[model samples]
Target: MECLTVKQVADIKGCSQQYIRKIIGQGKITAIEAEEPINHRIQYLIPVETLPEDLRQKYYASIATDGPPVPKEKAVKKEKAKAKKPFEAYTKKEREEIMQWCEILEIWQKKRNHFESKVEGDRNVVGYLKCEYPDKQISVDILYRKYAAYKAGDFGGLLDGRGGWNRGKSAVPEVLFLQFLYFYLDDRQPAVSVCYRATVDAAKELYPEMVAQFPSEQSFRRKLKKEVPEAVVRYMRLGEKECFDKAAPYIERWYDDTEANDVWIADNHTWDVMVMRDDGSEVVHRMYLTAFLDAKSGVLTGWNVTDNPCSDSTIFALRHGILRHGIPKVCYFDNGTEFLTYDIAGRGHRTRKSQRDVPKPETILAKLGIEMKNAIVRNAKAKPIERTFSTLKEHISKLMTGYCGGKPSERPESLKRQLKNGSIPVDSEFREIIDTLIEGQYNQEPYGGTEKAYQGMTRLEVWNESIQNTIQRIASEDDLNLMLMRTTRYQKVKRNGVCIEIAGEKLWYSNADTWQHVGDEVYVRYDPTDLKTVRVYDVEDRFLYTCQVEPALLLNFIEDDKAALADANEIVRSRKKAIRNYAKGITDRLPAEYKIDMLDLSIRKAKLAREGVNIAQSSVIEPIRIDPVKETDHLQELPMASGADNVVSIDIERMNARAEMRKRNKRR
Candidate 1:
């Protein structure tokens, strides 16, 4: 009986395939399971004979109007056939030789009358056939059959039985195959041999009858390879990245029509080069560079290098880009904690109470009408800046001294010792080299990824050309300084100044005007790099005053001040270290057999001291909330005894004297 696929019924009914499936689900239309699946998804086919008369008529009418929807079985059969091409059945030489055979047969048929006359004249016809087809062994009857087949179907007839020739049928049942597939296609990537043995064991243990239908290991493997797609194997073995790289179709993302600074992509990268501090110290450190790349022109719009990738570094990089290149229309970045600041990305969910709340990083971008978008997690290809970092690490970083490979697997054998003994470049030198490399070499090189208009031009050239159309939004020096401040504090104005503690160092910020609001909490914003000056704001976030560091605390430069402060910090640190050392030494003095409880006298005393408590001494005076005179209205006079009708007023002075006497007696 003829059957209509779900798609066919859907087309006839003028509905979606899912709707047709819904109709079947609702019992409106009956459907039978298709013999074969489509695209590894199970399908249902509706029998034409079993359909309602009205629906059948409608289907016929659809066929008359638009063509009939292809049947599932036929489509599946075609798909299975197409999986192995017909050309694959024959070798290149065999196919070429077969075509030659067809050509010769055609010639022989056309000149049959001439050949027949030659044969009648007692010429050797067999000898003539043998000489004409010297390379091939062919009889007259075989040639006639070949010629007839060639006439019927051309070249296809020659390769007709080649595809199905001697193909052995598998004894394995579909149910058993599916059961084995579950084990074979697991992400653990078990060996095929193991999977096959395990599958056989499982089958014998679970369903005893199905074990007979199980094919041999070799046959099972062959069928598995043929039935299962390479995509399934890749996904099961190497996971989504491999599957996406190999099996998934690539979708092109075009930004050619976009203007420069319309979209910017930013990401953090730790440079491979070992850079020394600006103080010319022997200590080496890694530099983290946060860079923003223009999506349209592929230019390095803005970048900042610091010792670490923090919200401070990220915001500084953004500010640098915005100040010079103007505000981007869209800012695309990953969901890093550094990027979560409201100053750049904007305030997300409020998780804390607002008490002298400072503006978020996103607030800055919001003012400029820039949209912040986060790239999907684990999807690196979504960010253009990732590729930028990769290129820099590979081509640029490798050329520098004390270059550490990004991954352990990529490091050289001598890298460990070389790193320790190497003369690392100072921060200033590293900065200069990077600037030269980016501007002189990288940006000036022909960039193939640019738009068609910039096909032959360099990235820098393209950017210069594109930026001509953009309105310049250069920030003033004052604005840059204000926007780039990272540290925020809420402290009350004191008589001396506003005392702020950061990294265990106390900095006194003072202005003459701050003395007026001595008790009011002021919002203080300052750059961590420059603590000498802090911008003081009122509770309303309005600029109140610029407070300079106290003359005694301020140094000519930050590094000098840090060095002086570090020495002072060391004194406090040494005291704590000595205390810990003494505690450890006391604990070690105990005998090996001794097992002292943590709540022992010595530990208890130490805990009490740590908590700033003198447990040996006690306080007798605890303040009471109410005074006797204040509670006079609520305090009512009561009878002294149950039998007495006369009410006795409370004697406040006598009662206090008696209470004091009772306390003295209890202490005695």
Candidate 2:
């Protein structure tokens, strides 16, 4: 074999030098392998008879298009090199550590969003991890830089570095809520006194190496929408989650709410909780609370919870509450169909028969003669039963306060010797604390009105007053009869000179005494179920006449386009100086100054003054004066301060009933 240089070949083949070079590099045609002086790499030469054949003929074809090919000997060496085993990878423990650090970084990132902590707070995390893994195979610097990138933009190994797949997803994001029970704040959970964000902070002295072991708060939250389970962190939720701590029983004898028989209000309230089962693991459950309340006593009957919707928990709670409390004459409830509608109209007056897929009335409970008092749809004020839930929450909060201390931490501690033995401390332990606090400090705490009111009455006294007054005003026999009657529209007719009509075919006749004048349209009180029946008098001992039925539309109180009553309120009170002045005469002189104030106007008025020095002695006047410091003694003579309707009644009427009561008790 013989070969020419690229320049020599171009000269012999009548092509450019670059063309010969292209043929070699393109690998479209081959040259023969031959030994060279230095064979360290490779040597080749072309065969003189080996010109390309027809398919490979024209120079216009893809002669130099393909990339260069390796020589067979060289290609074999490349294959053997590729076949060599790859380097060994990180061990399982190392992998686990990496996964943990990523998780910790993720959690730290989440904490940033929920807090105003310094950037240093976030930076310190990286600093810790770097210090912990100083001698690791993977550089700590790389992890820090990558995490910094994640902070700005979540691309790259964002998920990989955070505890995305590696972090356990057994609990929801609520597990991320860092709750610590402070024994100083609450003897039990129902009473809490502070609020902290559910996240880690500089306050948490976690080691630098641990960041990678936790999930970013964001990852935990995102996983919550998908329901990733995690351990729950328990805390006293009083001050942070709800009103448990501040609520003191104002009414000494609030109706006990835990009883099953009375008012059952079922609604949803969030818990700042970490639910712990018999196992050591924890979870956060969004509790659906259904507790029974004694309408008369304001006592908590009982309560229950459920993890999800369409649960049996609410119904079960109602059953338990009912059994605990006596079967209420009128059991109050909300409109959730699951509990009341399990059976038709059994326990309540109103049934859950709305067209919107609502459940029917509890026919089973109603059969037992238990009537339901459902709150007005969307109106929380319509039911007193629903209003008493704070009583239970407050009770629980007071209990929690006893067991916690400042810089608070809640661990299972032996309840004070007064409570019970620690090993068997269950509900019994919690209950003992509740009772002790209620008796000692809680009942002694004074509370009167809202931020205003009487200011110092104990919650027990206030609670007692509210219930007693409400019961007297709205739950008396007078209220029942009036509430039972229904409204009916009727027209005047001739029935032996009486108005007659039928509602549900029930019969009633309104003679001249009740019907007075025909052709006067009036609303009447009648039973809708039995129309002919007229309900004359009501529970409040008042006649249900047409005037009361249509008071707003029929009884017009307008005067000069404003309410007559409002206009009357602007008049001077009968006992004021203005009234006395007006009664005697506007021109009469006042003792304070020898000046006459003219009130009523005259078209042509003139002032009479004696210009001459010889005025009559009878015209001379003297000013009357009294010391204001002696006002207390004179007040009984002067009209009650001023404008008082009856000065004698001021002491009995003006003093706040509660204040007066307090004064009387103190005097005793």
Candidate 3:
């Protein structure tokens, strides 16, 4: 291969030297950088032998042609890499939201006339934006940025990270903030400002240098509201009740395969109505309504309207439910004193080591093999009875004549205006009203949460569907008597009969078969509401007799006069005994120095004649006595002190000593 200078190539090819130099510059022909003495400067030359065959042919052919192909268009230069945008760092959801904003902006831009036509009143695009997202308050400026980003790179460009430097990050001392949060989460949950101030103060004490880094109260609040999760905030501010009811993770808890009588929830409700006493007199009294509902069926198994709620009242409600639907597998109760009583929980007293006489409810439920369960305190959602009560009050109770609203603020407008004027039905009338509502309305109405299987079915209907398969535990007559009866322990029998005094009234139980056992001990049981007769059980736990109200003194003869006469005679007997004891005490404490005259016929006659007093004479012998010493005008007088300074202090040391007698009189 032989090398050739650029000038020779140009001469052979019949082209200018500059044209050949241009081809070499374009690298179409082989070229090497070298120094040329002719121009005394650095230059490049081509070798004819090393030239590409195509280019060599083109050079020879161009000599034959008019001119070499015009230099191809200058090679296009590569574009510098596109600059990365700030929005590229945004999260996926953030990008999505931005894209949605971009869509709205695009719509606003494309249909400007249509959007303007839809705008009403004095508002513009903002009103349209509000219409689009009724919940969110989007602004035009926010949409402008979104549109710019969208135009730049579509969805990816819509993402933005501006003004988010402080996001998900806090400057406030975390330990101090948590301490303050815990303080607010307590039962006394304080205000937000209070918690903030507490945190600031604590930060000052614990880490003074970091106090300056703490954000403003408003900024801190925004951070908490935006960055902190709702459940975390609720747990800190509202305590467990709110956490469990509102913020806790939801769990679907259905009975699954449970039947109607599988579980029963019981609770006591204070009714909104004001019922009067049975005496036809209006009174300011509220009635308590204790009720039981089948958990599975939502049926009103039993309910009772009473003046007060106690263990007995709770048992009454339970008994009513049991009689109607049989015994349940479990009785779910609230943390009320009535429901938490020993009777239902079957808790034995620490002082009473023996379970000789357990509460009737506990005993009966145990015998029936039923269990009791209590819901967490203050957690109303755990028990469905709360919802039932709410439904009842809203739908039924509010329509009643004397419906006192649940709260003072919820009182009816009519009731508020005429506070003093309201219809308070008598006890019997109120009872009837309650019975009608429970039986006819509550039970017969469809439950709000009825399953698809039982849709449109009344609670009673659902209950009836499963009632046949239920395990029925019915109480016998004797069992009912024993369970419902209130017991009085340590009662003794008296000669008149097995005398038992109740509320200061003596009651007697006498049977031809057991009258001879008058001096025995007995346990009495009866109904507090109806005290006409009391059942007596002997020491051997055998049924002895039924005691009737016996008035100690027969001052009146009438049926149903048990309490009135018995109470009167008790007062008479109490007064006589008190008088006798008082007289005996005075006689025994009489002064030994004085020769007392118990009776004097001359003095008595003179006093009677002088006073002109009459006495009722009795066919009884009277004893007369004379004074051992005659009355004298002179008598020794003891000095009296007017003040504490002049008073003398008596000392027991100066008293005479008595002997310890060996012989003693035994008195029964």
Candidate 4:
């Protein structure tokens, strides 16, 4: 009537309870629950009904299913049990058709996944999606009608042109497009390879304007840079359940943190027109503006309007905001492509204040844990950033792009012409115009179904109240360097001790005692975002300094520049424009702190072998292996002996990284 506890079973079986629990773990026994013994060992419980009449004989026979164990009788019985569950008992024809459809869907899903994984590889999907769906509307109508007939059972055959569904060739093709929808979460894509067509061709696939049929991965991404919002549309198309499965958890986790500074959103958008021009030329330039939108504020707390939009456009905008308004905890953005990059993943700003090398206009933000969320391919709801940018473009950016004749130096006469057309020039003039026209617009901004509606106040009003008198603590040079430095310390041995001294002890972290750790070869990792603590693991054959600080830190020690990684991980990881510029120097002068002022130092890199600006390994990064923990010989604490064992053997071999860096420095 009652289930047998693991201890009871173990007692009867004359074995330790752990052995009984292991049997359950290996699926040898079915269990009701598991418990622990007095020694903290686990015990499993089993129901009496689980035993079969011949179980004892089978157990004694020592059946091994993997080898010479399966008897013919049992094998035949197992085969019958292993048969697949039957499909809804469909008529043979219907079942056959479904199988065909399943095959097609699976193929389509596979092809889509292949393309979505890498930007360049998705050219085929893009090519298909970019074409216009000339007959998509007609196809939908025909498909629906055909589906109706098939449902009613009046059709003679279930097969159509595709030999699966009776739906005729419509504008939409036969591909299942879940993969594209999935990868395009929001507008915050770091970089997207764009394949533009000069002209539409007949063979080119076409997409209808209709929202029902989602665009192939191609069209969605092509227009993404231009379309400020609509990045999350595809995922939303998934039934509510799928949407919940993919996004609800992230949302719940976000709400749980509830820390205002935990997540921040920043983006750049073109602003309203305020006409100004080059020093002398009458050639007009429409100032393409950008903003780092603070989702919390829903305001352009940090914004900039420039003549041309480039890769570094967003970074400059961020700098302007931090120097003036203050640093936001998080910056949200859309897949505008330019805004998303591995460089900006966790970084707040790329330009170091002390760097005299002139900060690279574009820099990697991922070194810091600055929560970056890119909008999905066609969904704007995920990126409130695009919506905010749209408004800014309409009311503010349009003014900045106002037709300007020339700079103030020569445009004195043009001001009269500009005034006739209502052009405001300079920051002060634009400020006045915004004060008069845009002041109340935010209050009137309609937020019907969004969360803002319940909050009552417009984003601006709420943000102003929330931020009133609050001062943000800026990371000083010392603060930043401290954050970047490893908690390690390195010192040479002086006393006749077998152990070597190491630096960065602050970096080593573990529940395991480091004081107990004594090894010649060592590797340690520190959190890039929080450098106070480090994870230390023993070195093996490989070491990489640039591995992202998180998951790679699982082990405490690491080897450097081992041949194994080259055979495996030699390709560039997800890269940013700035890193590409200095990739070569990244390994140069690494291991030692080069001048912090040199943050913006640019090296010429050869891509496909021609030379251009790049990030040199010697300048940006260095790899270091953990130095061995010092050994003491007071003759105590050796597990084997009282204290005579004095082996100075440390296994950590140096990563010829220093030699490589010296070579690079010499070249430079």
Candidate 5:
């Protein structure tokens, strides 16, 4: 038998060494004295078999290694057979019951010590404890066991462990429970009853042995509610976007830090009302409103009503906003193609992929020095303008003549009758209604104390007050028109000039300078409202010239109208004259002597080739020197330099005569 130290036995029993020693002295446990003393005192070692049955088993298991029993220095501390429960693990009622029992035990112990006869003491104590706790039945054996347990483990030993062993555990088999989760945690979230039935059927087919162990549907639901987190269930069943909207943390935007015209948010909204086209056509179309709202003042600064959302409408709306409220420091835009066009916000700003070696043109916002920011894709809550659009739908769209609902399910039942009767307002009338509601009603309404600065004022009042302190960067009409003009793809200049297709009509535009740039590809910017002229820029976006529309000539030249013929002829004459003048201006800049020198060098090279002389082997060509002073004084004077006698000079007139003779010979 292996013997253990007093400390080792105390550690196994979870008691102190002094208690083990006291028990040993009282002959409650067997121990032997060591031949050698430890720390100048008698050393006592308890036999492993001398421990209690449970403690002996624990001790034997701790030292049951294949090797010899562990040395004293390397002895492993024995863990308790039963783990203690924390104080908080007990319920309030259970804790109160425990305290009441402890009080009774304390009193019983005092009474037992006070009486000489322990049996009488026990009878009286039991009577007293039973009366004090009238709801509980007390007995001598119960008190003795409770007291023993309390002395062994203190307060934790008094906790009632019945029924709590399976507190959070489920009766369902693991395989069946997981199968239930498979059917429940799906995008098409099935009902708990449905999932439970499916789980049972699956278990019957795949796990036949586990089928009998499956619990009821209610047990499965209880387990799900208790174990699975709400966020996890939502994410698994409703999809990531839905989970984010419901559970994700988000930052709140503060408008108090921003001033009027500090930031503008733009988005397109389809009006809930249907309107008829203004061209007297019976066809109806839905209107789209592209608008900009000031973030700070909640003012709808500018907007354009159109049949569809496009870059043109976006630019027009932005232009209107800038002209009315001055330039904004930043513009927030949605990830829509209409707002993220290359002409409005440039390429690669908010997109993932980018084109290599492609030149990014300066966009409208960039030209006006406004920073562009894009909201997260598919996240409508990030844009404050979406809220404005909602308000517009409620106040403006619902009150229109032909009110259609925003969604197919919400559409009015009488919309078909209204459409057939042409009860909808025309495009112009609808636009007028929108303008009236947005400017007269929406902007003029008082803010409902959303922001501290605009608590008691209307949006317009707040905007006006803020503008008084702001240095508005107001742009002129011409400047705004130029900045907001739509650009076209690379266009080549033909003989007629550069042609751009506008409203399905090919319109040609040209200027005096365009004639020189024929066959060159250039970018053209023009206003859709005015097709009279277009601004041209080089491939690098440098402003070249402004081109006006070229007049169309009469196709029939045989018409017997002298005035028309004369007008056409004069137009042709002026164009010819312009070309002739342009050529003359270029030629007049050249000196006669320079022209003569060029011809002379050509003639000399031809002459040398005829004589079998290689021009490469000859000296460099030297021009005939003329005396500047003598030439100015006299009308005709020819003077040669010192080395001119050895060089032969050709006459210009003779060379012309020779060229004419050669041409005549070829013709004969």
Candidate 6:
């Protein structure tokens, strides 16, 4: 009698080889072991008669051949041709259905032999399968057909072939569909009906013959929904930013992976409630809240409310947070002009075309050793502070007076009345309300995050617990105030010191060292909150000195109050001393051999002139003669001449006149 190996039996039984081996080991199926070991292992062959009759038929049919049965394992490989679609190409639900069918076939193969006929066995199997899977409807005819196909081509035959050829494709003409897409996929985001009408009009004008064959508007809508992915639709219609925010897969940050102060995120939100301006005018404006949130604990560590978002507000908010929660190692910020300013994140941090000659000054984050990371532009979902703002809008802003809605459409009907009636809170009152809500309500509320370890704990509680073992980097108030000062602006040192404009007033800050830098352009950083002193740095960002406010000059010049006069004199004396010291320093560096005697140089020049070695005359003024010439005795002793012609030589006046004329001509 013919026998089948375990593998062949498993193939015929539509089950795994291990299942057959297990059944044989349990003595459920009769098997004969080979007397000789094959390849260091005993081999078993089960008689064909022992299998279920249906399985026995399949086993014989699989091995039937014209001359000799060919082994399935040793079958010749086909020559390479067009690649077939992989099994993974099927949808998830389709693949699962195929697997279920395979399992049903395997069960049917094992149980068929217990019945008298194949039909009865199939009926019973269907009934059992139906009971086992109440959600699925099992049919005996379909099962028989599937089994026959499976026997012919194994697993591939079970795949659903309906609609496989043209899946995700449409029957509409390509040109017509392209025209429809041109109208539909626009940034303006026209409605489906409008796009359909536009497409029809274009088709009627451009392709008049094909207009009748065009699909209906409803068909176009269905095709669009079926063919285009949601992300692609958003990208084409709404905007790339919206597409990324709504449909893009994002990284999930695990809060437990970091300590409480390890990372912080900051953002600015426009509060929904309007508040009266502090200028005492009858005008109201919406307030902006700049806040820093501890990413791990979801706590609002610090925040500031202002009429608008600016670098000052951002810096003040950061200072508040750092003062209370200690410095964070990493700070996440968005690409806002305020956050990306040179004072916060440093120059050229996330910008283009930075000045090459200018040195990148140290920023607040750099000074405090905090790593500043910028989030993707327009990606609000990445910042936890945005969620905090949302909570504020919902729980806090709605309860306040003059609460305008988030958008114009959502504005309450009574908001205009409230504005006219002057029911809005003042700026200070609004700030107080914000502080109360953030500290007393938001941070103190229980954490609503996916981290199981912090479920029952409040944000503040979690923050405190996480930071129990952490070594926080704390800065003194003086140091923090200096670091958080505004960005350095180019200022030329005046005669007094450097003049900077603060709060619409020009203030002069003078330092003893500034005298040397007079008329030199330097960078100045000053705390707006404290304008008493300003820090100075050279062009290379090297710290020079801290300059104090120059004292006001005394108006009482007649009075004997010499305190102000003394201060002025002291500044002048310091400046003069600085100049003298600088000059002396230069002279001290000179060698004695390089010094020359002025008188000796003049004598050498005169000696060169006497030697007739043509030397250039000095540009210096000639010295006056020290010795006086005595009156000549020739004038006193008359020279007697016998003739009057000889006495003509006594005309000294004409001789002196000629000499004076020659001197005047030489001078001219």
The lDDT per prediction is: 0.72, 0.42, 0.68, 0.44, 0.81, 0.80
- Cα lDDT for residue 574, model 3? 62
Off by over 4 Å in 4: 1-259, 272-274, 323-329, 346-364, 397-458, 464-473, 476-668
Better of 4 and 5 by TM-score: 5
Q: Residue 240, candidate 1: how far off, in angstroms?
A: 3.4
Clash totals, every prediction? 9, 91, 0, 121, 0, 0
On a 0 to 100 scale, what is the lDDT of residue 450 in model 3? Answer: 39
- Per-residue lDDT over 226-329 for candidate 2, one digit per residue giving the tens place of the 0 to 100 score: 44222121222234323422342223334433222334444543222223233332331223345555443334444554444232444445444544433344
By TM-score, who's the top model here?
5
User: Candidate 1 vs candidate 6: which has greater lDDT?
Assistant: 6
Candidate 3 per-residue C-alpha lDDT over 1-668 given as tens digits, one digit per residue, 9 for 90 to 100: 45667776775666777666656655667877689888777666777667768657876676688766455578899999657545657667776776677677766676555544544322476677788878655666666666676677755445454576776776655665566666565556678798888878876665543554577887667656776688876766677667767876665557647788788899988888766788866566778889998988898887888887876777778777777777788888877777765434554332155654642322445556678887877767788888899988887788777777888877776664343664556778888988888889888988566378788888888888876666666776557656656555555666445654554775665433344455787777666556777777776667877766644444556647777777766755665576566666766575644423333344556778989776878889798875546534445576666675665786532331111111111100
Q: Ten-residue segment with the worst summed lDDT in candidate 1?
A: 76-85
Q: Estimate each model's TM-score.
A: 0.58, 0.22, 0.51, 0.28, 0.66, 0.60
Q: Considering lDDT, which of the candidate structures 1 and 5 is the better prediction for this target? A: 5
Root-mean-square deviation of Cα positions for candidate 1 versus the true structure, in angstroms: 23.3
Instruction: Give the higher-TM-score candidate: 3 or 5.
Output: 5
Q: Give the per-residue lDDT digits (tens) of candidate 4, residues 286-321.
A: 456566655545555545555656445666665555
Better of 3 and 4 by TM-score: 3
Which window of 10 residues has the lowest lDDT sum in candidate 6?
626-635
lDDT of 5 at 454: 70
Q: Write the per-residue lDDT of candidate 1 for residues 100-126, one digit (tens) a residue.
A: 777766655655556547445223443
Candidate 1, which segments miss by more than 4 Å at Cα?
Answer: 1-102, 113-140, 147-156, 160-164, 167-186, 190-224, 275-284, 322-327, 348-362, 420-422, 450-453, 483-510, 515-528, 536-542, 548-668
In lDDT terms, how accurate is model 1? 0.72
